[model samples]
Target: MNLREQISHYIPYTTQETKEQEVILKYMDTFDNLLARENESAHFTASAWVVNPERTKVLMAYHNIYQSWSWVGGHADGDPDLLQVALKETKEETGLTTISPVTENIYSVEILGVPGHLKKGIPIATHLHLNVTYLIEANEEEKTTVKEDENSAIKWMELEEAIEACTEPDMKVVYRKLNDKLKNYK
Candidate 1:
């Protein structure tokens, strides 16, 4: 299915998601290249809520720009298949070759705000990430290495500890919601 149809059919887990879902769909209509960062103001991004088989732990990366532990994801970069984007990012960011989706459906949706920051000495303007998240499972036994350009460290953290380790207040809520959804997953 196409990105619009996927988001259209998604049953949001929160009012936030429902609201963001609406905005995402509208943005899809309003922008010419919604999947690429060329639009500048807002663009599509994909994230993986990586978890262990038992779902008791989450794989997190210490993001260089955010300066905090965060979920692994990246820009859609013109890719309409956000699931493939999410999966590819999970491997690149975490250095884990063994990872797979828990389901093909989107696990959550959010319109995330990005503060303007310098990356590789170039200043980036503030923008919005029309973020799509997928639930992914990885082998905890596989060793993880960080992608130096993006993150400084990577680890498998206990679910609650992962929340505590993340310094972004808004993301803590998102993480909590993702963890809560685990009960109904699978």
Candidate 2:
């Protein structure tokens, strides 16, 4: 299904997601280039909320740009398949050879505000990420290596530590919501 159809059919888990879902749908209708970063103002992004088999810990990377522990994700770069984007990013960012989705359906959705930051020494303006998150499972036995260009470290953090380690206030809310949803999966 197309991104619009996918988002349209998603049953939101919270009032926040319900509101963000509406905004994302409007953005999808308003801009055709949102699938790529070329859109400037807002674009589609995919996130992997990697968890261990027991669902007790989350695999997170210390983001170089945000200077905080964060989930693995990236811009769609013209791909409509966010789940594939999430999987590809999980491998590239974490160096995990084994990864699988807990469910093929989107696990969460958010319209995230990204502050302007320098990437590879070049300035990037602030923008919105119409983010889609998927629950992914990985073996804790597989070693994780950081993609130095993007993150400084990659580790499996307890769910609470994962939330507490994040410095972004907005992201804390997102993380909390994600963690809360884990109860439903069990």
Candidate 3:
């Protein structure tokens, strides 16, 4: 199945709370300005936090290009909507069918300009991500296959374990924020 299909199959669309929508809208506005300022080649991306309630483990992908362990996510490409970008990236990287955000508690992160493509050594303009970490409850039966192009491997890791495993400080911050958010959720 294609990325869109895969997302629809695995994740359900949960309604966004008023505050969440407001934050998302603000991000979208900022993204619009960023796109205009940056080159057309620049892209937007999104990711999801797939969790297993029974094990309290979260799904993560080993990004081959970056050589880092991170939550499944990717670029928005031409899609103007950041949420769609996140949904598409999550499905493409994880091969999960259905996913959605956790409604009232979405997180927005602004990653300043970082190294572009690792192999090519190209420089990319700074981009903003209005990330909404979805607390996805998935069964073992649902995670079928992962895309080899984006991710080398996919696995479920305990929140603390995953946080410790991540080498990048930024990624660690994201993980911790998500973990704290998950506490209120439980």
Candidate 4:
């Protein structure tokens, strides 16, 4: 099946999130593109929370745009392989070559409103991420590098600490739910 179809088929673990994802899926006609920016509107995005093997810590970046510590991820940019997009962004952003999924199932999904920010020196208006999240594992003892263009810092944080580091108002709810699910996962 295609990536959009795969997202449509994904069953979120929570009824509320499932409903939110269904709503986002209904917006897929505009979401299925790199140009889906819709004049400061929503677009499809793929992201991940990279955890340690023991699942106690998560890898996060201090996002330049959001100006807060956030999960590792990026835009789908017309790429239908969102799962691959998540994995690829993790590798590119964190320089981790061995990240692997905790499960093939989706870790979470949301329709996130992104505040307007500058990208590539251009001002981007506020937008939405018809966002999908995944849980992946990476080695903490392994080295990491900052993708300076995107983030100022990248490091391994205790899962609780990561949870606390989420400063985005809407993302706090998403993080809490994601944390609860992660606990149930392993």
Query: How many residue pairs clash (N, CA or C atoms closer than 3 angstroms) in each of the candidate models, in the order given?
Result: 0, 0, 9, 0
| Candidate lDDT values, in order | 0.95, 0.94, 0.58, 0.81
Residues 1-186, candidate 3, lDDT per residue (tens digit)?
432332323321223333444544455545553323243333345567777756378888887776888887655555545556666676777787766554423343434234555334655543444343445556545754668777788887888988887887877876876676576664
Residue-wise C-alpha lDDT for candidate 2, range 1-186, written one tens digit per residue: 777888999999999999999999999888999999999999999999999999999999999988999999998999999999999999999999899999889999999998998899889999999999999999999988999999999989999999999999999999999999996775
List, residue by residue over 71-116, the lDDT tens digit for candidate 1.
Answer: 9999999999999999999999999999999999999999899999
Candidate 3, residue 152: Cα displacement in angstroms equals: 0.5
Error of 2 at 42 (Å): 0.1
TM-score, prediction 1: 0.98
Worst 10 residues of 1 by lDDT: 177-186
What tens digits encode model 4's per-residue C-alpha lDDT throughout 31-120?
445424543577778899899998888898998877889998888776777778899999989888988988766778888887777789
- The model with the greater TM-score, 2 or 4, is 2
Ranking by lDDT: 1, 2, 4, 3
> Stretches of candidate 1 above 4 Å error?
none
| Comparison by TM-score, 3 against 4, better one | 4
Count clashing residue pairs in model 1: 0
